[model samples]
Target chain A: MKLKSLAVICLGLLISACAASNDQAASSGSASGASAGSNSGQLSRDVTTTTSSTFAPGSQEELQASIGDRVFFETDRYDLSPEAQAMAGTWADWMKKHQNVQIEIEGHADERGTREYNLALGARRANTVKDYLTSLGVQANRVSTVSYGTERPDALGSNEEAWAKNRRSVAVVR
Target chain B: MARILKILIPLVLILSAFKPAMSQLRVSVEDGLREPLPIAFAPFVTKNGASPNMGRDLADVAIADLESSRLFRAIDPSAFIQTPAAATIAPRFPDWRQINAQALVVGTVGNEPDGRIRVEFRLWDVLGEVQLVGQAYVTQRENWRRISHLVADTVYKWLTGEKGYFDTRIVYVAESGTADRKVKRLAIMDQDGANHSYLTNGRNLVLTPRFSPSRQEITYMSYAGRRPRVRILNVDTNQDETLGPIDGMTFAPRFSPDGDKLLFSAEQRGNSDVFALDLRSRRRERLTDHPAIDTSPSFSPNQREIVFNSDRGGTPQLYVMSADGGNARRISFGGGRYATPVWSPRGDLIAFTKIEGGQFGIGVMRSDGSNEKMLSQSYFEESPTWAPNGRVIMFFRRTPTDRKGRGGRSRLFIVDVAGGEPREIVTPGDASDPAWSPLSP
Candidate 1:
């Protein structure tokens, strides 16, 4: 049986469960990512990103043109920036005016990071938008989220400028 | 890691050469990696009027496989004193030894009546003046390439007394189009880059194709129907199924050591956590529930513990916890962010992607987190996958993109852990996220 153990693999679940009492030896920290649990539900003043541009009301094009339905972030951060907070406020106001609109928040990241980590980071960004809008009275059911990780970049280049432009979250109206 | 999924095939042994006890040649795997043995090859000659190129092609492929292992050096055929036919009939040992050859390999290919081909090869210990191996394999003409791999693997195992990875395949993402809107499709090929094919069309995007450890299946994340979900694909049957009856976005998927479960990261609301789902029972269990991102989980070969990449440390780093998430301990203390921690098939080492000082590197460390050594670094590099034997790692490296924001030149590369320059595995276009399958028959 001892030799057979080397060839066959079972989930670590069984061992961890049986060794719960022994686990007290290695207590550790949940640390940094856990600190991100606090949601910034605070919505700032309404400041429309585009005042001159005209948009086709009641259309997906309006989300992109009139209100600038996107927010940007610093590298590896999901919290909405001051500018992103202003953009979120405008988005909440737009959602209130157009009650029929349902939005899918698409989280994206630049190519400077790893695949799985970037994916999780992207999800954090998307969820941050969802949380903000819901806190401002947007129905939770009206919002969905998906993360493209570093797979879909908005900018094509590898420079800092392109990377900055690529790391963003876009609210797609449905 | 070199555990092979062997399809039983009947091979005939024609013991017409010297007895085994007379062959005194023996080489350990350590010697195979360090000091390459010099051997002479006379291309296999054709008999019974088989395709003119079949014999020579077989010899070429087998020699190439042996050379790829970095265990044997093929002395130039131009230096051979005897013709291939003469060597196949009866090797002139004195002539081979005069050229400082430690070993000699010769073979023959012949046509079989039932629309098949027969290949026979002989390995001779030139110093011992004795035959080490002589066997005949009968396979369909189209499967001639596989037969060459079999020959290489057999010789490799017989020489070094270890499993051979020559007969295996690799799956990776074939990238095209612009950097922003790349058409990423899943592509697979032989270990040496032959018989290439695409698994998914570019209509939707796909990423991170991982092979099942026990079956001819793969799991990946696909952005189809406007959602990112974990998907399981049977390579042989072309049957794909969504991983769950449960929701949200799923990515960073990997199969358990036994291939009976899947470990992946899921995002619900705004948090990312690692989860394990039993394939047989459809039971889902959360491995790590810390608010910090816990992703890219992998089981040790023995299933006793799991290693993962997590950002619980503020920056991403490698962590090892009991397989059941009993307790977690950080394993990486290096001055960099670490991601994609893949435990070796041998359970002795772990390979990871390290990002530091504006550079990305591929490195390996002992399972206990000691003796970390970076094998290669580039402008951007990640996704280190281990060969079944755990002696080599395959990853993708991307050069900095151009001014137009166009994607850089990304290609797959392999490096020997024992030490050597990395070699590029060229595909039709840019390729990334390479996963190597166990040795297959």
Candidate 2:
């Protein structure tokens, strides 16, 4: 329908609308850029964009589907809350059941603090989960960690809900 | 000192005619930027006509440099009673004064026999009826921008007795993509955002580019390694190399005052600490060792001390310690968190990012942490870097993304240390983490 209207618009203004043709080219270019940004940005104002493909048991997706594979933290705080603690317990049990599975915990922070400051904070948050899992009998060698700091975010918003979700550590089975 | 700076800045200014050409009758640019002293710039003429339009282009560059500082108002060429021909021949003091121009800049762009461009400019004190400063620079034709900046620096030095920051480069992060998944590359440009070029590709993330004192290399954090660590990019050789063998997620790198050592933060199992490494001897010393997160260490001008940010007190705050890593002391006592403390090149004040109530502000304080003042506030401003002269501060400010997180574009801004409106330094795209280089050697 968009192409049909664009074609009609171009045909109607064929002679005088040099601007129309240029606009068509420019609009198509921007359309792709916008889609790419939104594809990677996932920066919607509304929450609930998190989804995964068909989950196979014992896979990361299955772990995420069975019990959330990530734990959120408070702003600038590394200590886990009751909810995060519970999430870590289940993640520990899953790791214990699958002793062959090795995981890399990726830590992240919201885009509120200085870039370097958040790098340290994210590392701490990832280690907080790493230490928790080790205490819960997850092998230390089985669990590695990397901090993306504020470089990556799960949710891309400036609001409280988005920031809360952004401050998280995700367990990825490698 | 502030009073002296005020006396130096006013374009309506105050350099009383004490003698002849020795003390040129130049004026100050005034205290606040609201009423910048009116200065007129004549369209520079090509003497040999070899380089067509380069004279006008060079004059535009110098004018833009002075105007961006918010200290001088460039009077329109249409308002000039004296034409370029007349300006190049002789300065008609009365003609410039007629247009209410206290200062008039006239120049000629000429080509040398050696295929070099010679840029000459003379700053006339219209109010005092004398020439304030005149300089001639001969360099490669492509270096016309640096020559123009030098012209501006000459005028600025004579007018304010403070060195100009025009002939400098800003090494920063050129960002693309979006919030959740972004690509950052090592990028650089002149202080005025000219000759922009990316030094690194987006294959790996790069951030926090700090220029070496020699102006030939930059130290920054890059994820191209096994983990995030410091990497050195030699500007002249166009080569890249990891910093050291001693590494565990190293980041937040800054060069020492003499450019012989590097200060950076390395994290081991979530415990981060500041360390300094002498580049020549390969000797490394831990500056801050604690359970808390300590990073962003910058050397003092004299290199005898260091100012860094640490959260040892339960919150991120500025701290000072000796260059030898002893006697750590907290300096920031504010309501919110403090980070990125950079010492002024003049060895007086320190610039930092202050986060309070969800708003980020670029602020400065004395080395001892007194006389604190906020320069500019925004949604997300971080990483304050000082100009070569320490008269201005540059930082990156990010606007909040929309509901779809579409437009959280980050840009670089420069604010006068004397307090003025923050002006955006236009770049190719979303830019951040600007590190202002020293004046051209």
Candidate 3:
């Protein structure tokens, strides 16, 4: 009976891995096609996602792998975007699977406003993500938030693409 | 004393000898001297047998002080023809009028039988063709420079209708070394950056040295042994004493308007809170009890209310509370975060740092956080300090390098609170975290 249960767990992992790989391949293929026409020295600048294949035997790895690295925000706002909502859904699923994991949501803003205002904006962004995860069944106690404001930048270049990348919320496992 | 007087007496003589050409000068003393007051300093006419340069030294020091305030446009000495003996010794007013001089300063320096030096001067309103004011003082020759400052202050106040900040001092962290291993020294200087003297050698990191409202003591944060604590240093005595319990990190300290208490922020465990310690009783009372960071506390001019920056709103924002930590209310509701909310000495506005769109800027608003105006925008700027008159503010700006994640340089700058062109204050090296001193006594 124990051997049968272990086989079932392994199969579940395999199926999820296949699903993630298929999604990755599909996204990368579309990204490549989109890059072809926009080669004006900006084609290579793709928002790449790197995920581990082990899958953590549950949805934890899948959720973190999908939304743990990249941040999304609404247009002309420091607030989280719908993409951020979907990302938080993954985090909630991951928290449900791995009840022991705790996470911090770090919010950031683009470099265009006053320092103090940007700090508050970043905090709002992080809290928005944290709130969404809580609503999706993730325990509020397991989620923390911090606002780096415009102090830390993921993309150092001074361009629209760089700014878009910098305006994000990242999930950091604690 | 005689040796020092020998040097000062000759300068005074030259000033009095040339006083006749400056008598008719008139100056506007009200509505803020928008333009520098044009004043003629006639060479002093020495009554006693003294060196020709006798009175010129005293006059020169006074001239330097007034001009450094950037409020006076002094007539060049070459324009003077003859010196008058006293305010009563009048002559060619046209020469001063030709130079468009609005006021004239004439004085005499003579030796007393007691071996002390006696100096006297009069401020003439040339347009009104009358002596507006006159005064006399006796002092040892070593005190001549201070006497010059006092005279300047009197003339400034008489003309501007505002208390002069010229005789004040500024205490700031003199930064050296590199970004990774920085060395900061506590340095004090005349308001115009003259007579700079290092109060503490660069043995540790020091931040925000604030002068006592009485101008006798300074309280600052120093990590002398890698432990952040506040130390009060008496300038006249050169004695330093650490404040209260030293187990936690203490920073952002400023004296109350009354100078009876010190307000500061202390980080115990992981939470930063504002606290006030009575100067005489040495008792500490926590003013903020939030789990989030609460720092940079400043007292209102009346000392009845306090404004500070806190992250209790899930982000840093300016908040005002009673002196006893009652009735806390958020004052900032706009888009961004605010830090270092320093209340102006006049009790009208609060200056702070605002971060938005990846840029740091210095901004000011009403004490209630309305009418917010950003004064300067840069890659990085923080720490807004006010001039005693509440007309100007000083802060620091850092310019990032061309490439990413590289070292940058920072410097001190000043701007009018009304949003004019920002001017950089020249220092010998990279400087940041400036705190303006109260007007000197």
Candidate 4:
């Protein structure tokens, strides 16, 4: 599969080089770019996990699919509520059941605050979840945290509902 | 020889007698005019038949720059009584004075021998019937627009006793798509909205592009790494370098006044702190180590202090500290949440965005956080950047998106810092996060 993808990339590069000399090369260039984009994602996934076909009972995929993988936060607040706390507890149990699975916690924010301020808010929120997991016996070394600030949003609307959904922390299996 | 000396001696005596009186009558606008000063602009004439019709085009650009300031009213050229040829010969003072024109601008454009363009312009005090300023510039033909701006700056400084911002450009985010899936590109254009070009393709989400003090470079936050981080781009060469391989997210990047360092925020383990990177030595220094979110830092023009926003007081408020991040004192004590504090180039005031009762507004306050005054109030507006002269501010105002985050539009707006109606700046598409550049040298 690796060889096939590499071959495809080379072919696309050759075609793009030829297309660059022509006025009608714009469409072909995007086609090659799109192929390269998906290939990179597939390559990264291949490097991370040995088994990619299905989610096992205690696997990270199952933790995300069947169990909760995210918890929402209120605007500008990093402290978890009762509902978010319960969700974090469920995630903690899953992490213990699958000791081999590592998780990265990503913090997010709504579009209200300034860019960097929201990034800090998201970082704080992600750390809150990481702290909760550690308290529940998930090893500190097993969890990593990063903040996306308000750059990525789960909801696009400007109303309260959208904002509430956008402010969240997600546990992604690594 | 005797006959010529007799005539020349009398002419010299008359001119010396009138010089002081003409100088005294030269208009010195001491304050903002209640009404824009009426001025006449005769179409620039081309010598040696350049044949590009650039003469009229260049004059129009200068006229637009003057009129946009809301300080000068360009009179209709058809109303002019002085012919273009006579304007070059002698001052038709009565003709301009009859039309109530306080000032007159006349210029000539021609092709130089070295394939360059030569532009010469003179500003006349119409009422006083004397020339105020005159200069000539030579540059490549493609730089005609810059020549026009230079001419306008000459006129502006002579009349207002203040520098003009026409020669500057703006770096901003040209946004498309909806709130949920936005495509933003770093775009730039002249102050008058000409020569619009995109620096980055919309492959990544970009925000808050800021110009370096002296170079053709910008620092902004981008998500190209799948995590938000600060990046710098050299505008001319299109080279981009990640500011830091920081362990966590970094955002809100701004160049120091000297362009030797950058200030931004970095997050780790749910704590956000302000950090400064020395561009020359490639070393990073943590400025603020508080558990609170400290970001949106701006350095004073003198570079001795910085103003930033922090939520340490349980709400986001403006704060000031030394350049190294010691001695932080809260500067905002208003009802609203203050964020995005930018120190004015003049160093007298700081502009910020305030959110109160779900309404966002732009405002200014003293450097010590006193004399707070709101400039514009609307549904959603933020990111206030000062014009080069510090006399005005430009920011973006976004209308609320629909339930699905559709139908939202963001437009740039400029308002006079001394208080005036906020006017929308026309962009080809939705725009936001405007950063005005220093006046072009």
TM-score of each: 0.88, 0.86, 0.64, 0.84
Q: Tell me the DockQ of each model, to 2 decimals.
A: 0.34, 0.34, 0.07, 0.33
Error of 4 at A8 (Å): 29
- TM-score for chain A of every candidate model? 0.68, 0.68, 0.63, 0.67
Best by TM-score: 1
Candidate 3 - CAPRI tier? incorrect
Tens-place lDDT per residue, model 4, B1-441, is 111101111110111123323543322333333577899987888897564588888889999988877778899989988886679667689999999988888888888787777777778888677787777777777777888888888788878777889888888999887565678998888887777888889998898999998877899988885777789988766688897577777888898888899998887777778889999999999999887888998999999999998999999999999998899999998887999999999899999999999998999999998999898998888999999888889999988877767767889998877676888878899999999998875
TM-score, cand. 2 vs. native: 0.86
DockQ of 4: 0.33
Taking the tens digit of each residue's C-alpha lDDT, what string does model 2 give over A1-174?
A: 222343344444332222322232223222222322323123121112221223344566444433445777777899987656766776676676667888888888998899999999988999999999999888899988888899887666788867876788888877
DockQ, 0 to 1 scale, candidate 1: 0.34
Please, what are the lDDT tens digits per residue for candidate 1 over residues A44-137?
A: 1111222123334545544443345567888888988766776676678778877899988989888889989999999999999999999999
Instruction: Output the better candidate (2/4) by DockQ.
Output: 2
Winner of 3 and 4 under TM-score: 4
Worst 10 residues of 1 chain B by lDDT: B1-10
Candidate 4 chain B: worst-modelled 10 consecutive residues by lDDT:
B4-13
**Between candidates 1 and 4, the TM-score winner:** 1
